[model samples]
Target: MTTAGLSWFTVDAVGAAAPPDTGPLLLDLGDFGSDRTELVGAKAANLARASYAGLPVLPGFVVTTHAAARVRRGEQLPEQALRTRWKQLSGNGTRALIVRSSSVAEDSATSSMAGRFDSVLDVRGWDGFLDAVRQVVGSADAVGSDAPIAVLVQPMSTAQLGGVLFGLDPLTGDRRRLFASVVAGLPEEIVSGAATGTSVVLSRGLGRALETVGPQVPGLTAGLRYRLAALARRTRSVFGSPQDMEWLVDADGVLRLLQSRPVTAAAVPPRHSRPLGTAPIAETFPDALSTLERDLWQRPLDEGIRAALELSGAASRAVLSRPLVHSFGGRLAVDLAAIGAAPGPRRSWLDLIDPRTGLRKLRAAWRIGRLRTAYPMLVEDLVDQVDEQ
Candidate 1:
């Protein structure tokens, strides 16, 4: 085991000498692979696989599903074993620990139950450790499934920066591009929409940045960019699919792999089957235009829409490159789905009702209020354009 300056060891080292009657209650980080996913759950198993593949994963241990079940049933936990493992992880020093949920349903290949479970961070003292573990284990109830739950415990690193990396473009599902959102502290802020971090786009395999949106973030250096790309490539190679991973940079500038799961939602919807609408576009261009007329009018309309999307940061270049409106028998129909898919400020009432959207609802309402204030000016401009035409 590579401790990386922490006192870490494998479960095999201790389990080999123990009596056969004792089942696996806890396993050290990197000790189990995908085979033990049933016992340790997907989240812990994926982290272990990443560590075994030579990723800079933080040293941690998994309290197995069996142990969590015991806790759930109000059984007396093996206090001695828990204390010994905590000692090894803490290195007998005062350091905060993080206890996170690792249920089988939570980081599966098909669904990533992100932000749905509880994670207790910055834990200290023995009582705090027990409480954090209990909290994580209890969070499994929120899944609404009787799936076995495990708990992952790690000594929280004093990280200078943290963020998430998508091996493929999350918004456009472009496999050749990587999307990164990074912040100065814990990435949970970005996840909760408490902080709108810097968004960066890089070439998937090469990590060469194509564009960056938002302000320049501190500590996101050139070397770190390369390392992040390398990690993405390795994760795809190891997992046989692009992954969505959370990462942190410690005070020493070493990047630590925090979590890894398959990028399930990156699959794009089929383009051919998308239903198109003609209401607004037909109103704009009422008659069937000739080829020359279409050529003259389409460019200006496309340019105008693209300019608005760009100015609002609602759509990506990949989306803008594709034509939003198509002509069938010289009658135009707009790709309404494309506009709806864009990350615009306007959100549906469903967004307001979703508990998961958190602070984003407030942000969206604020943006909508500002847009509403400017609506009259926009209408006046449109009226002037119609009159001139």
Candidate 2:
């Protein structure tokens, strides 16, 4: 195993060993030389150490930076090639695989660069398995100029429920509070920022559940929290900021850490003092704007408008001040309006001015003006609201 890019070797043998060959040369975490290859990345190295100490971990292997560099140099070894590598690793068997990006720069002792790489799960067979690994490694190469890709190939363990756990709330970064999100099945969609489903927010009662589950496995809960806190502390130490981690629990209920990184650029800055008075109206408006934008992206205008109105607690049957269209620029204008509305309080007027309601208003005003071509008027009104604020 390699730790922090430092390579070490144990046995001098150079050839592949036969089956049931648990040789001394094959580095486990207990072996220092294995650290040279398997533990090159911080996250992988940490897991190796944890697993070596007899922690519950899914059976897996790591493709070290040395191997990755060899592949990058155009080496034709089938075992080293990602697509064919799995066949050699897994033999001829049908099993689920979890391919993750384990880069030196990611989940480092100091920095936690989150969501800067790729991870693919539930892959089956050698060809598709290799493609997923290649995709992850390639993504790192594309976005991470200086970081070398270290691949962690683990058998996909069963998971009845999986999500993320934070020692502190990600939104507020309050150390006094711990937050957890539990969802059924694998949490791929949620982690990818695609699925917005029911997420349970843990606080007092949930926090107790985290603690109660600890004693069943000695040091399990403590270790998890310790690792999480250590990651956060190290991240802040390295980058002068906090971090967000992605972790999951396997079918056996063993917590297997997947990735860690800094929070997104859009997270609110840490607050040091209490507010003196009510927050500005602009602050509440963003929520409304985000709701509208999300629905618009996920559904048609009519449906999106209805969803937004319902979410904003406004009647969807209210009339609009003007007509609207589905033109490219017009749709873009609505998007901009949604974006603007996201950071502030919802407006009853805006919520009520959906497609159906707007159509009614347009028909009522048909004698006064050409209602079919009045989308610009709605945009103008929204812009005016912002200007007035």
Q: How accurate locally, in lDDT, is each candidate? A: 0.77, 0.50
Number of clashing residue pairs, candidate 1: 0
User: Candidate 2 lDDT, tens digit per residue, 89-179?
Assistant: 4555467787777777766534456668887878887677767767776776678456666777777766655556554554444554455
The 10-residue segment of model 1 with minimum total lDDT is 1-10
TM-score of the candidate numbered 1?
Answer: 0.67
Which model scores highest in TM-score?
1
> What's model 1's overall lDDT?
0.77
RMSD per model, one decimal: 14.9, 16.0
For each candidate, give its TM-score against the true structure: 0.67, 0.50
